[model samples]
Target: MSNNRRPTIKTVAARAGVGRTTVSRVVNGSDLVSADARARVLAAIKELNYVPNSVARGLVTNRTNAVALVIPESESRLGSEPFFAALIRGVSGALAESRTQLQLMLVRDQAERDQLTESVATRRVDGVLLVSVHAEDRLPGMLEEMGLPTVLAGRRDAGEQLSYVNSDNAGGATEAVRHLLGSGRKRIATITGP
Candidate 1:
């Protein structure tokens, strides 16, 4: 035994060979479950030290006005890039003005990516605003195919039919180069294509 806090309904379900819903009913003062099964789950919960996640409390109130903002990157990378942080601030500020909560999600694997896919397909969000999209990321493609109301912070590849807001990269570059030329830096070289 690791000697941690007791297990929760979710953990107990895994241990007792039952579904989370069954364990949840038992936990939420439901008398519908069979006494024998409930007892088994209770015992398993006590044996393991799995703390329940915040989902339990969320269930009682039946409210989670949270929107998941998925960013597929590492913490270090996120910190290094002002683009994501600024984008998030704008998104949060806009959402705050509308009195809606935002949930930031950082995808590190297929499971997390899949969750984003499900959210869009089910209209789980009033709208989804994607940022930092690569040229070949599959999530954006899937989201587009689902025809969900999505807004991208970056441009879609080639001919992808999706709604998005993008920075004026080309225009900004042009302005910068023109300024350099006017400033007598005629041999100035500008790097594009990230």
Candidate 2:
């Protein structure tokens, strides 16, 4: 093979004195190949510095091996909120263990939303993790309609049908108020966001 050409499966197979199918099986971690064939393929791969093309593998398997974390907030909000940073760190750490890629998407306007829609339509990600859900937001519905696997950080309402993870905000607030009242704070006020 020429030095200019990258090593292909066929080249590895030739070097290993095995068929292309045997090399493919070994590369893909299929146990169908005999031990001797597997060893030869491994040796050939190391010798040629062969690396499988992930794009080609994904096309053949119909899996992108990637997930999108979609946050519909602006960059300022994402940066300012400690919640967003912690969420990103947790998600990235989890995905790293599985060797999956994470795509962070910010959709603050119609243009960015349109881009997200295009990405989803193209099946660019295996799944989606959506954050900052609101009752009027149509993104969750759209993702459901497309049959994409989705999980939200919060629900739109009590009647939400999508999978979500949410904190007990009402319960926590009630507890806080109870604690304040018990401490004789008669003129306590609370601050909240819209």
Candidate 3:
């Protein structure tokens, strides 16, 4: 093999004295290979530093092993909002366990929305996590129509058709008011924004 060429699965199989299928099975943790073959393949992989091609694997499996976190908001809002930061951290940590990649997408305008549509159409991502939903936004419907696995941070309204995870705002507010009343705070007011 050339010095500059990255080692392939074929090279690992050759070095391990096993077939390419054996190498693949071991790499994929299939538990079908013999102990001796598995050991040999592992050793060869370490020696050759053979990194599996994720793109090729995705093509073969028809899964990208990635999900898009679509935020239809401006960069300023994404940066300024603590909610977005926390949401991103939570999503990233969850996806880490599955060895899936997170693609952060911000769609603030028609052009950007079109780009997101194109990406979904291409099957570039396995699923989507949409945040900052509005009642009239058509993205959730579009994603549902495409048959892509999608989750939202919040619902568009009481009649939302898509799956979502949202905090119990009314319940939380009720609890807060109870606490304040218990503390003898007679005057209380609430503030909210979009």
* Highest TM-score scorer: 3
For model 2, where is the 10-residue window of minimal lDDT? 53-62
Candidate 3 lDDT (Cα, 0 to 1): 0.92
> What residue pairs clash in candidate 2, if any at all?
none
Tell me the lDDT of candidate 2. Answer: 0.91
Candidate 2 structure quality by residue, lDDT tens digits, 1-194: 78999999899999999998898888778989999999999999999999987797788778888999999998898898899999999999999999899999998899998998988899999999999976789999999998999999988888888899999989999999999999989998987666
The true-versus-predicted C-alpha distance at residue 55 of model 1, in Å, is: 14
Residue-pair clashes per candidate, as listed?
Answer: 0, 0, 0
Candidate 1 global TM-score: 0.55
What lDDT would each prediction earn against the true structure? 0.72, 0.91, 0.92
For each candidate, give its TM-score against the true structure. Answer: 0.55, 0.80, 0.85
Error of 2 at 13 (Å): 1.9
